[model samples]
Target: MKKIEVFVEKANDGTYWGSTQNLPGGVSSYGNSFDELKQNLKAAFKDYLEVGRKLNENWVQEIEQLTEFEYQLDIASFFKLLPIKISAIAEKTGINPSLMRQYASGKANVSEKRAREIEKAIHELGEDLLSVSF
Candidate 1:
C-alpha cells in the first residue's frame, strides 16, 4: 500500500489545515480543531483521489484500494504528535537549538517569518526525499 503524507499546520486564525504534497493542486482541508481537521482531511483526500482516478485510467487499481492508503503526519505535525526533543528538530532546520526548545515547550512565541523558515526547511527536505527513487 502507498502512503500519503499530509502536512498539518496551525493557521494564522487558530484553525488547522491539512494538505497532501503528493496530490494535485487545490486539494486542502481546514478545521477549528485537530480532530475536526483529521476528519475533514480524510474526506477531502478521498474526494481528491476519486477525481484524480477519473482523470487517469492507470489510477484505477490504486483508487479501488483507497482504503489501504496510509495517512501520516509530516514535520511539524509529527513533532506535535510525539514528544520529540527540540534540539533534534533544530539541527534538522538549522535553527538555534535553544530557541527551538523554547518554541517546542511553548515558552517562546514563534513569529510568522520564523515559522515559514521552519516550514520551508521541512518542505525542502521532503522534496529531496521525494526525488529519490526506491
Candidate 2:
C-alpha cells in the first residue's frame, strides 16, 4: 500500500488541520490535536473512497490502496508541535537565528533546501540523544 501525502498546518486557533493532495474534490480534516487530526483524516478519506467507488473515479484505485498518511508540516507548525527552541536549532545548524525564528513563526517562506537542512540538524540531534547512557 502507498502512503497518502497530507499537508498539515496549525491554525490561528491552535487547532491542527490537514488535507490529502489531489482528488475529485479534496480530502481535508481538522482536529484540536495531532491524534485527532489522524483520526479525522482517516474518517474523511474513508468517506472519499466510498464516494469515489460509487462514482467510478479513476483516482480511487490508487488512493484506496493507501493505508498510511505521510503528514508533512509547515515550519511554524513543526516548531509549535515539537517544542524545540528555534534559536538553539538554528545555532546548531548554522542557520541565522533570526531567520529561523521567522520560519518558525510563519513570517518567512522556507525553501525546500532550507527545510531539508533543518530536518537534518534535528535528525542529528536525535542521533546524539540516542548516544546517551541513561
Candidate 3:
C-alpha cells in the first residue's frame, strides 16, 4: 500500500483547505475552520482509501514517503486532549454545533476560521485550568 500525505493550510478567506502532497490535483473540502477541515480530510481520506482498496492499489507507502521528515500530528487526538467539550468550543466560537460534531466525527469539513476559534478556546481553557491548578 502506498501512502499519500495530506497537507492542509488556511486561506485568506478563513477556510481550511487541504491537498494531498502525494496526489497532485487531489484537493478536498474548504471548511469554515480547522476542525471542519480535519473532518473533511477524514472523509476524503476514507474515500480515497476505499477507492484504492476497490482498485487493489495501496497508496500508504506513497503517503509515508511524502510525509517523511515532516512533523506529523493527529488533529483528532489533539481535539480530544482539550479540556473543554465541543459544545463549549462551538459556543465560544459561535460555530454551529452540528458543524463541530461533524468535525469531531470526521464527517464534516471545518473552516480555517473555525479552527482558529477552536485553538483559541482550547488555549484559553488550558490557561484557565492551569491558573486554577496553581
Best by lDDT: 2
- Candidate 3 residue-wise lDDT, 69-122, digit = tens: 221223443554334477887787687877877786557766777677777876
Candidate 3 segments whose C-alpha is farther than 4 A from its true place: 1-75, 80-84
Error of 3 at 59 (Å): 30
Q: Local error of candidate 2 at 103, Å?
A: 1.6
Off by over 4 Å in 2: 22-24, 126-134
Write candidate 2's Cα lDDT for 67-86 as tens digits.
88888887889999888988
Clashing pairs in 1: none
Determine which window of 10 residues in candidate 1 has minimal summed lDDT. Answer: 66-75
- Alpha-carbon deviation at 101 in model 3, angstroms: 0.8
Give the number of colliding residue pairs in candidate 3.
26
Per-residue accuracy of model 1 over 59-132 as CA lDDT, tens digit each: 55654464533345434455565565667568888899988877765567778888877767666767887999
Cα lDDT computed for each candidate against the true fold: 0.68, 0.88, 0.61
For every candidate in turn, the CA RMSD to the true structure comes to 8.7, 2.4, 11.7
Error of 3 at 68 (Å): 20
Model 3, CA-based lDDT:
0.61
